[model samples]
Target chain A: MLYIHHSICISPQFTFPEVNLEELVRSTDHKLYAKLIVNPDIPPAMLRRMGKAVKLAVSASGPLLKQYQNLEGIIVGTANGGMEDCIKFLNQIIQYEEGVLTPTNFVQSTPNAIAAQIGFLSKNKGYNITHVHRGLAFENALLDAFMQLDDNPGHTYLVAGIDEISDYNFNIEYLCGYIKKEPVDNVHLYESNTHGSIAGEGVAAFVVNNNQKGAFSCVKALKMLHSTDKDEVEQAFKQFLSENLSDNKTVDLLLSGENGDSRYLDYYRLMEAAVPGAAIGRYKHLSGEYQTSSAFAVWLADYVLRQQQIPELIVKQHSGGNTIRNIVLYTNYQGLQHSFILLSKS
Target chain B: MKVFVTGMGIITSIGDSVESNRKALMEGCCGIGMLKGFSTRYAETLLFGEVKFTNEELRNMAGVNERGVSRTSLLALHAFKQAVSSASLSHEVISDSKTALIVGNTVGGMCLTDELYKDANQRDTGSEYVASYDCGSVGIFLQQKFGMKGIINTINTACSSSANAIMYGTRLIRKGYAKRVIVGGTDSLAKFTINGFNSLHILSSAHCSPFDANRSGLNLGEGAAFLVLESEEVRDNKKVLAEVKGYANTNDAYHPSTLSDTGDGPLLAMTKALEQAGLAPADIDFVNTHGTATENNDEVESRAMISLFNNKVPAFASTKSNVGHTLGASGAVEAVYCILNLLHQEVYPSLNFNAPIAGTGLIPVREYSKAPLDHIMSNSFGFGGNCSSLIFSRV
Candidate 1:
């Protein structure tokens, strides 16, 4: 059994520990960058060298590490990691024509930098790894944590998903038709009849343990698939549910990765149909869309389960329950990689 | 719960196939030379272990006619196809939806750094190569081509990427998530990496000499390698190459680019791996060391080995001297080399080593010799203090 003890999210919404989730922030930028609540506890000397993504990751995980002890490992999932530093290094290479270049950008550009930074700050010297698969990145991290907890049975793990937006990367996605062409308020994200969804970036971290005491929720099951066939996805979903949940129990809430893009909305419809009795909710409108946006949904699910209430901003349809109990989070990337994660209140 | 290696395939600077790579290792052949496959401004200054194939030739070798396909993907496909064919895996088996594919890569399709520069500058209106920039693109291409329906993941932890990939695949099998997994790594030489290393001042101008007293730095290399790992039940009359006895991963939390002088991460990794395999220090017959020829790595690694083995270290060698450090592919490439050692009962020589480091006085295997070996260990340490070790025992 895997249980989540603590979580911290740095997203477009007010998701920090002190902020009220009921207050939503509206944005019209092409890219919805995360508003991080800087933690003054971190020394200024250490904060001076970190990039935006690194700072967000370290700050978000800092409080959790303090609250929890004996972290056995750190696992991170990122699609585009340290993009600011990567672009800086690339620009220097172009400007100098391969002459002398600074090493700071090169040093911090790797995808594992965030994980390594967290490990260094926490002083935990156990297993550390970074997963970079497009959509399945976070699911892979979660699954690895689950397996590790299963094997050890009592150790705590730190799992996180982080990504940053750079103007260069956002422009590339815009040109490739991955972001909305026209600027729209993020509150009206799903209402636009557009070809692409709004671009967003954020970081989310969780402290996971095998024990359920003082935990917000327990992870029941997690599954990932690379196929796009509807029948195959449905079969995998049914098999996963049967293997994890009892047949008599039904999911209380279903969170779908339904962006405003018409091209990929049918897949969400298919998933919603699979669990017809559950209340439907959407998170992209609040968090925007990224490869690892499912992580934000996970944080949201944990919050809802702990608070025993669903915020109106995220509720797409009310069907089965007045109180949150069991939740399923489903997300896919460009109709290629699909993920399903089940969570229940503790 | 035993996991076995059913098949292995590789393409590196020394050779293109497993047989050729083994032959080159036995014959003490070095593949480091001036860069010829790709044009770079540093072509005349720095040496590299290029794969000796142009992008066009590699595309033809991989039977890929796609215009925008990167060299990284082509190299990966070539090795992947060889591994699948060598294992006699049928199309039905590959598309079974239970076989996972886990790949590690640092420079995915960004090998076309110049094209990316142009595209980023808006000089071109979304080039076809733009889609191949992310690290997941290579794995996605392989999954699409092979029609793989199972779990697919990509890892990038600098040089230790593929070692962790192998470890992750084993865990998935042990946990009953997948019956079989295709695990490996691929990286192609690119200016992005070359310039990055150059800025760090760790790129050697000559062929690297691992563990030598007067070693300068590391030479960047590129290639791909894959191993087919299957559960014991799925082995099903297949010839088992070797058993993945034990594995462990640890972080130094020391520095972003260098290991500590005490070598805490490497020591812990090797010790934990040995403990997992239910073996002692004396049981390991040979070791494939992560000797990158840098001033800091060779000494740190030597100290770690001496500490773990209590000054009675086993015979060891560094293949980086022969093929240069292949970065992300170095881990799996070295793992394949370890497997070959167990299969042939031979220890390959470490070329370009004349003397040991001054402090630890550790000497690598200087000559190729045939020996009856039962178990071997491989070490891979990456930037950001990521350290991993794998033990393979003869079945």
Candidate 2:
């Protein structure tokens, strides 16, 4: 019953609106250092208050807030929420002797500040929560919202997953070998034999409600893996297919968090092996990799389900149904934070 | 839907454990004091309800090796150990997959972070001390403390962190994720948070008088509290302290540090929590408010309470008068205070209150009162405009 009324994403690629998804996917050859959402009209004062993740959340959550006048609850997911702002303020305090660090920067440094900012600006307040459990952060928030929706029908919840790449973050990842040294083409992500995948940034939000009004799709099921291996994923995927996807034929499209790490590729390959005839699509090329970027997959699933068309750049095959009906998304962080989400047309 | 508290533990200025806290609350004693835990140049200017225990004292209490864990982790381990033992689930449930540890913390070993900054040779990135700042240390410590490794997590949404942690723990249990969860929050007095709030100029130079006319600002305190939340199946084995009937979280987003003058987010959270409990404003017999004693916080909280009760506000008091603002643990600590109120049918006084504020005519309990209480509402509001209300009913 959790219907995604609206969703928005901001990444290094040009994937802001629905139209930009194709453009972003088509032009994903280069490594994106920082993904700052470009909004020309918003005044500098407002923009200064937002970090990369905050901007993306605002843009995505704005449309949802406009659609629903009252928000019953707000839940946010982030792996490293506002770490950029934290570094900024801490650097100031360490370097400036605690003289006059701007309160604005320090205030937004907290992870939940994004939700608080949205609630304050929209003047909608009911319930607000922030999750920071690495990749499962978004899943936990989604689960909480789904439970809330189930408990109280006919209420809308704003759920957002956000994370940004900071200079410190990039340096640490580089030191830890979490980012790729060699850049590769977007279409050949799985083919690239690299030690690490490119680190990216993004924020995606959904206005979830039980009242499935002119919605494109519904969240069929969400399952997270704690001690999952390739075999576990395969078994879980088969279980999900048999129980939820009763049709048993094939999923229309499969969006995956394929970050080009050979060690992590087995899970996605297992998923591909499960859904034999489904078209395979990868998003880390355009969106890069963050903790909650799987939210982007949910957005993509909703998009293809609503439009009934897959962008040529994302379509690995055309053999599946031309009119998209089902999407199964697989996401993980370093092969540890694995989750499978099933979405289908209403 | 019927989650019961099987065990409770708290460490605060008023008391070090549940029994002492109950005694102090029943006797209506206050624990606020001039800052004596550390040597502060601003010592004359600021008063705090800081825990009197030093790092060595806490380590001796926990019987842990020195220089092994951060002070923050030490305090957390203390409270978490007590809660786990009080629940009697220590040896019996170590391998229980249904048992999880969820902690709410704001400063994750900031004292260690500061020590590293001071001692160049002692600072080692490879050490567990530095890695503890990941905010997972509390969960990791709790896991090792009892040798239980189920669902481990931490909530760090500033002040309302523990309230949200409790909320998520209940939801996870209700959804069958876990059968029992050791859920609570902990924070230690650190130069980092103390200086951080001090830099914001919201730290009071005197005792915090929540909702009082002369209230200037908050007096920062630090401590921990833990409650064992059990599924209905496990509640019968242990005495049910109270039931977490309803809870809600809302964000104000008005300002990063300051709350909105209208208190919209807090009002919504309280109203929704009451509604979820299937109770009206009149049903609440007493209210434990998040009166941080800040100029804006107390006034805004007072306004929210008045608007929610429509001028017929329940008998209320800010236990912060005794413990100061304990940051993230404030929610869970105050929640235990509310449960204690329901159990004993006593209302503790809000100290240093002479007259009500100008516009908001609400008056907190100035002395101890014994009354039959059915339901009590506890409010916890954080700096990020993160507001939460948890309602507890006597079982």
Best by TM-score: 1
- Local accuracy of candidate 2 as per-residue lDDT tens digits, B284-330: 99989998888898899898888999988889999988898888788
lDDT of each: 0.88, 0.77
Candidate 1: residue A87 lDDT (0-100): 73
Tell me each candidate's RMSD, in Å, in order: 1.3, 4.1
Query: What range of 10 consecutive residues in model 2 chain A has the weakest lDDT sum?
Result: A25-34
* Chain A: TM-score in each model: 0.96, 0.91
lDDT of 2 by residue, A1-346 (tens): 5898777766666656534665644324234543555455456798788777677677767777777887787888876677677666666656666565566666676777777767766776667777776667788778778888877798888898888877655654554456666766555666788777776778778888887777778888877655446786678678877877877556888887888888787787788888887888877877777778888788778878888878666665555467778888988676656778888887
Error of 1 at B136 (Å): 0.9
Q: In DockQ terms, which candidate is top?
A: 1
| Fnat: each model in turn | 0.66, 0.34
Model 1 stretches astray by more than 4 angstroms: none
